[model samples]
Target: MSLLLSFGVLVLGFHHLQSIPDSWSQHYVFVKFGKEHTLECPLQGEGISWICPHNARSICSKASTRQKTLHLPNLSHKKSGLYTCTNALHQSYSTYLLIDEGQDLLNISCTSDSYTSSVLHCSMDKPFTGPSLLRVRSYSSNMTQEGKEMKIPQDENQNFLFDIQLPNSCPSEELMDPIQMSVEVMSSHEYTSRDLTFYRRDIVVPKTPENVTFTKEKIMWSNPSWTPYPSFFPLLFELTVRYRNNTIVTKRTEEQNYSAKDVQTIRVRCRDLYNPSSWSPWSPRLNVRA
Candidate 1:
């Protein structure tokens, strides 16, 4: 009788462990809008049940469950949320569903003035005309920066600008890892969030080459004043020169000095040689003759 009672207690403890859900085992799924998606339960057995996304009333009601699998057809933004599947033992697994509309309403871009600058400038283009709230956040391996929630006002050109101050400059060792940037826009009837991941070298927009001087025989320019340790980071300079006969000549070189003749107008741009990024904007159009 004593042995029988000990076996019963052991069974009860195992049942209790099975009834607890595993919160750490979560998954994320991204499905395009107006598409079909299927979710499967990790546990296999009878008496499997699913708790569909709460926001999708229609889907929750119509979703078909066959054993450990859930089939969802004709997905929409409303179908985005947590989906949980539970077995007879009450062991549950959850998946967060994300619905992508395919159409991106926010045109976002990030650029730094120089490799050594600590500020990152980001601009978003508003394609739709309406009042909305915008929130931005940036994340590095070590830290997360949250931007203040602001109302997006009507702009003449439909563009909004924001800046993020990094804890370290672009070329610093701390920023060598990947950084994540996210933007969320919310309006009365719509809500969307976009995330972008990039490395520091990917967004460096060096300052425009300065002090462009041109002569009949050669043209010379100096690197941007903000460039620190110019010897360590080589630059590739591009020269566009127009001749007297309305002809144009474009040349690329690693050196700051170039030899040319019959040049009417000249402008220069530079980019990093090792980790090339977007070329700096053409130095203010320099007219050699005028």
Candidate 2:
């Protein structure tokens, strides 16, 4: 494959050639390394010559074509380029040859978790035995933002999953803003990339839960609840408490035992999922007695 700027371009007779006219048949094909390729010459006749893209002069000697067909076996880096065929009158036909060194088996699938938009899950069809890295980027309102490389464990299936959290206090304009996400899978030797464009209007941070009621195992602590509504996306709830005993922030879960702690103060907040870094502000504090 043409891996760098110097190796990737179409040049003809000194100046850089961008494209050919339709009359030229515009034959362009990609060949993998160590593969055979055949180039068909147009306007057949005698004194036929072939010119390689990198070199200025025509190829001479035994490296000639037969019956307007040039057969190349075991393709390599030295064989990669635009090949031009010409007649004695200087009339010529050309084809752009691209060398693909990347593994043809590589493919990626990326999807936002239906349970939670914050969590983007991606996987590769081909397993990479070598060093591998997965990178993601988001573009919104003409600005591009990038996330940290997610850990892709070398597993039997080569599958990977990760989540990205959006800020809860993000402005109203940004909630519905379009997000362009590009995911790249790289190996020690070769790499491939793909892009996804989406937006989150229904997945904005959840409003703070309300209706505070308290009970005391030791110090009275208020349990807050919100008027439940139908939710389209995954949601996570956060609780921030400040009391005479301690100040703490924690997510609500079935295993949580808040009454056991000498909780003196109480407030709460919640957000729709995307592993967002920010959360809703502390709600109005409840007067709980010790």
Candidate 3:
């Protein structure tokens, strides 16, 4: 009888440990500066707490009886980092945060009286420790849809500043609105990933002149606003001159001009890489006469 009782006790303890439910684990997409990003951490039995980086420190103390959604504050480019959640029972779960460093909205303020070209800088400042992707969209009556995209090299700091040209080919009768620019960043870890979004308003890029002017250098096909369609001439409107993943410095070279048989309108359009829902209203239509 004594041997039988001992055997039963051992069996109960082993069963209890084996039957413990696993913790919550899933993929999460976090927006840059979004409100109250919720991360649900659920576990079996009692004692649940959210931890950042490791189990030593807890983001929330005194585990609640029910599943908890860790409310994260507005995140920035630098906020991209590793996160973990664990239960008091010694069981833990891990995930990564990817913050896309780009603009969610664009707000442009132009001087009512200034004469020289206004300087507009667009960038994403979310912190992501990986490669970055950049996409630019240009809108005009004559150009293609779904602006151009470029794979920006990865970096830990996701701040970027790019210069764009304005519309010049549109006729005076039709005034073109300022171009919109969006930036996005994503973070990666061995076990997780996260993304963030940002936006800039009223970014102005120079427009190419209508008159016939030829350049010695040949244009590349990878530009977002460039199209080689046979129906329309291979006219280029926007140019990306320089770029840096960390500093977010993008500069444009000297103005470019392309002469076609007829004149047409030119407009710049960009969409947020992370959140396409938050985009600026289309710029005023710019009309150009040949």
RMSD (Cα, Å) for all candidates, in order, is 13.2, 12.8, 18.5
Q: Among all windows of ten consecutive residues in candidate 1, which has the lowest summed lDDT?
A: 9-18
TM-score, one value per model: 0.58, 0.37, 0.28
lDDT per residue (tens digit) for residues 233-267 in model 3: 22223322211222222222223432222223333
Model 2 alpha-carbon drift over 4 Å, by segment: 1-28, 42-48, 54-67, 87-93, 104-230, 239-246, 253-290
lDDT of 1 by residue, 1-290 (tens): 22221111100000001021122121233355667866767776677777865566555555365356666677665565556677888777665554443336668989887767767898988744665567677777767875646666655768888887665434655345777877765433234568888876788888889999986588999999878878656799999989888899899999988888777888899998877688998998878764
- Model 3, CA-based lDDT: 0.33
Residues 174-278 of candidate 2: C-alpha lDDT, one tens digit per residue: 446665776654432233456666555433333455564456453222222321332333345556566565666555632223453555666666555555633
**Model 1 misplaced stretches (Cα beyond 4 Å):** 1-106, 127-129, 154-158
TM-score of 1: 0.58
- The candidate scoring highest on TM-score is 1
By the TM-score metric, which is better: model 1 or model 3? 1
- Residue pairs with backbone overlap in model 2: 118-274, 165-274, 165-275, 165-276, 166-276, 206-271, 206-272, 243-265
